[model samples]
Target chain A: MLRVKSPQDLGAGLLFIFIGCVGLYFGKDLTYGSARAMGPGFFPIWLSWIINFMGAVCLVRSVTLEGDPIATIPIRPILWVSVGVLLFGYLIEHVRLELALLTLAVVATQSRRQTDLTQKIVAGFAILFGIAIIATRVQTFAFLKPFGDAVFGVSQWICLALFAIYALLTWGERDARQTVILSVCMSIAAVTIFVVLLGQAMPTYTADYIAPVFSKIGSIFSSIRGR
Target chain B: MDFNVFSNLMTGFVAAGTFQNIGFAMLGCMVGTLIGVLPGIGPIPTLAMLLPITFGLDPLSSLIMMAGIYYGAQYGGSTTSILVNMPGESSSVVTCIDGHQMARRGRAGSALAIAALGSFFAGCVGTIFIAGFGPPLASFAQKFNSPDYFSLMVLGLVTAVILAQGSVLKAVTVIIIGLLFGLVGTDVNSGATRYTFGISSLWDGIDFLPMVIGMFGLVEIIRNLEQESIERNPISTKLRDLWPNRQELKEASPSVLRGTALGSLLGILPGGGAVLAAFAAYTVEKKVVRNPSFAFGKGAIQGVAGPEAANNAAAQTSFIPLLTLGLPSNPIMAIMMGAMMIQGIQPGSAVMTSNPDLFWGLVASMWIGNLMLVIINLPLIGMWVKLLQVPYRLLYPAIIMFCCIGVYSSNSEPSQLLIMVFFAAFGYILMRFGCEPAPMVLGFILGPLMEENLRRSMVLSRGDPMIFMQRPISATLLALTACVVLLIVLPSFRKTREVAFQE
Candidate 1:
């Protein structure tokens, strides 16, 4: 009786049959005009019949034939990654969207393995938090005007230098260091080309729409270089 | 219907006759053949890429090039099947046995020559059918209301499932999944989102590029990756013969003729994809051919000649449903309709009367383009055969990277890459489970059409249940559908009855 061993077939067929019947019922509510002889419900009602019939055939075939044994389903990685995406969705309003997305990507990639769950989370958080700080300082200087700009600029340079050295030190152990580095480089390159060559203002992450730290830093660099 | 059509069609001939148009057709053939020879890539993306480039050209000229790519891909698929055991598309799989076996015996050259010859002959015959019969067919099409069209789509869906080589139930389920996937986007009439789950990007609906790239390009890469090796088996060194001898031709001729006829009929059916046509043709040929000395999986010359011709003929015939009814039978044709929309050309029955030049020109160009492919593919078979000699280790990485690029470029969205990765893994599991992807593809193509028709029929009938049985055409189709199901189930019923009586 097990020869027709397609569980996927059975599940899908039953689902269709159910949905088709629902569509058929919903279609019944509409008053189809006689202009075409068949009304709106005619199609779905007929389709549902076909679906039900097909489903029955499948069910019968599955019961009558000796099909291959069902195998175990893979659930962990798909679910874990889905959860990470949900978390990213939740964090987008508070954290920068790019940072949130990056964190999601990192955590999802890491969660594929069983042992690295804790370590992956710690690394993910550290990266997200670190980027958040840079964006915050960038937001601060732009909002506070001229006096705050110079102060933030000096601090950002020092912080950037420190982070670069720290990143270099950590680059040896993590394969994701490459992705992070590429991400940083690509973001900087795109921002630079857009602001300088294209003459567009960078959109700020802060509520007040303060210019991004990179733009202020670029302006400062330009003024200093002009001197 | 008017004298203007004659002038317009003549204008179409002029448009197609130019050096520029001819060059475009030739270029499309060359490009199409190369991509077709590569396993895993198909015509849609290649044609989509060419679509934008056609913006500057006359509409007829651009369409001719696209037609060239469409049929060129069909002919190109056989080349890969002949030399390597791999087929770029599901339909081409039938060609692999004899084609590669012919290659193994150092007659790869002859196998290829015959395939190309059969394809060219069928393409010519099919083109004649399209040219002479297209208008009459298009006129005859007006009597079809939405319900009848919908019923026909149901018939197509049933044909896909029953004819497919897997469990019939699985085919139905896979088709339903495809329909659900189609329903994942925005609701056109209600403006109510169906299944986007609040993702704004999905508000427009499931993108065709991602679905196609995921199911086709990604799945193939994953399957290839799972294999320990995907190298071409070694062939004999002599490899001198290039033409089919009398005995070979004698065996292949009937199969080719039979395949052409089957493909012509099946190709016109909605949801009847090229792969389905090929498989159907192979089954018919197997049933009819006496002695059929070569088993299906072994080197059978009939296997190569029939399916190749059938698939190409079917690929051409598929255009009839799309051009006449504005219904795209497959995703590739759907993309073509998108291209037509981009050009502000409506694809429905109005197109025939409104733009005879464009319509007739496109039809005529299909014949010309097929001829171009034959002339183009024959000499280049030697070049393609040399490509099979490349090592698999070198080839797999390059193929995988190309797959990644192809998936990425289809929509310029990295999300598709992710989908591809997931589907690739899923595809491997499908292969392991002995589930064929061909039926799934056919279902995917037909699902939405089936739903649309069913809805249209019910709507037209004013909620009356008996509309399907009342219409002669619809009744005939439904009865035929019932007959097919009964034919499949009757033997099982008898067997069960015997068992019950024995007890």
Candidate 2:
């Protein structure tokens, strides 16, 4: 049995050979014209051959020379994070951007569980909201208008600020709950930036599902003013 | 000659000096410094992540902002190297040798200030170098035939392999793999698609964003998460300590001048960029500086000043080839080329003639961006150090969000995210096998262009293989490429390369 001395090189050699073979096999059907009149397949076929030759060289060196071993790959983070990313892609079109973000945060944090870490994120966000509120004096000004519509609606700021302040004071929680809740808050902020401020045309549950509740609240405010 | 250069620079100033453009430049520098100062991230991923936001701006402003990010990274990278002994950007790895030492001795302020000041001086020189050299080089490139272009790309790819760290065989194979990937979209001549694997998103060729973000951005996140927790303890410094004494400044000035000269020249080479320039400057300083404030690697101020200046200068000048010959000198510039193409502008000598404002405005903005970096890095640096305290758990999620949004917002294709995942996994495997991904990126950017030119040249020669030798320019570039390949195979050069990287 020929034992592989340099596992890393051996792995790389195998990978290159695999990639090269895939290129050749897939590119076999395309017309490879003469050198003077090259086809789309000519370059790829030639490249695949070069790669195969180099892989052969690497394979030879793997057994003949000493080299480092491949480091142990940690799978837990890669799995959760990749799943989170894929889920975001699948869910965003079907759900609100905010909910998709929530799903992402939960799945993404799976590898790093039991987070008893202290987070002043809500507090920091409240401070930022306070500054934005003071900047325009409640008269609607278009912020980041280069991107799209004016997102500096005064009513929206007041609501977000109040919510952030409330969250900051009330969420003296610990562990997984804190992680999920904080990420939810952060997700709300991200949705506001991407969907509202940036005016990206992504489908959102906010417009269809949540607008009715806001309108009802507006009606109540108007009725109170009339009285 | 000098007068024409001055007038061109003045036109650039007038074009880019608008309030809106300058504001965008400042914003770019700030954001760039913030991201670049983060550990395990470099300018390539930083540029890729920020690339989408620029799609909305006017061409000149977008290019200005990208330029700011490019060099702002150099500034931010040095700060990370000094305070944390971690190289935030690969170019700053040399700075960490003596810079962290200076920081440990509580002279972090001095080292930081020297890096900022030295980089500022070099930035000014590099901008002027571009103004003086750009037109001449572009005019010269006008004479290049298709065969010559093919040979030049061959030379560029060879040198990129030479410069990429680790096994030459691996880098070569990886570059070939990149070339294969690059040829995946439609075949322009035959009107047939190449290797779409039946995916509609790939008909126009693989989108640069998903590939870059996946390879550099997502892979970076995965790599970081592999460790249990990253330990970061940045050295704190007060505002008052942000100055070097006259003696230290005097010792550093000569080294700065030497490094600037070396960097401005090296950066114009086909494959040299900020990383190589920094490494070379450190080696040169050790040989040239007679009396250091301290010995080399012992918190020598000269050590910090020389490499810092060299890297900044190189970063500024590396844009020359991309802007002039339409050839990106390094992976960062390749990303820049991708951005320019996204803006519907092919980077080449034609850009200078057709869109002089865009070209010159970018040159002028390089200087303004440098000034912005000096200001952002100095007194406001305490904010950056505080940012270092943000735990990795909270930070990476936001990075992922940004990467996802960046990749998706550009094309609005869900398939792009899947592509990102694919490249991320691919990049992770490459990393584990000790093959650097940087060369592959360069090859990917050049592959299509190389094939197109090769076909054109072959047609011109009617399949005669000796056509390359017949053309003078092609002959010369091919000769240079052969020499580079020889250098890569030489035993003595290989030993020196290993020693250089080990440092």
Give the 10-residue window scoring lowest on summed lDDT in candidate 1 chain B. Answer: B393-402
Q: Which candidate has the top score in DockQ?
A: 2
Taking the tens digit of each residue's C-alpha lDDT, what string does model 1 give over B72-154?
77677777777767777666777876688877767777888888888887787776656555666677667777666766666
What tens-digit string does per-residue lDDT give for candidate 2 at B382-449?
99889877777877777887787777777787789889999999989998998998778888888899
Whole-model lDDT, candidate 1? 0.60
DockQ for each of the predicted structures, in order?
A: 0.08, 0.44
Best by TM-score: 2
Residue B317 shift from truth in candidate 2, angstroms = 0.8
Docking class of 1: incorrect
Per-residue CA lDDT of model 1 for A89-192, tens digit only, reads 33433443334334444444333332454445445554544454344445653544554334334533433443354345446645445544544553344334
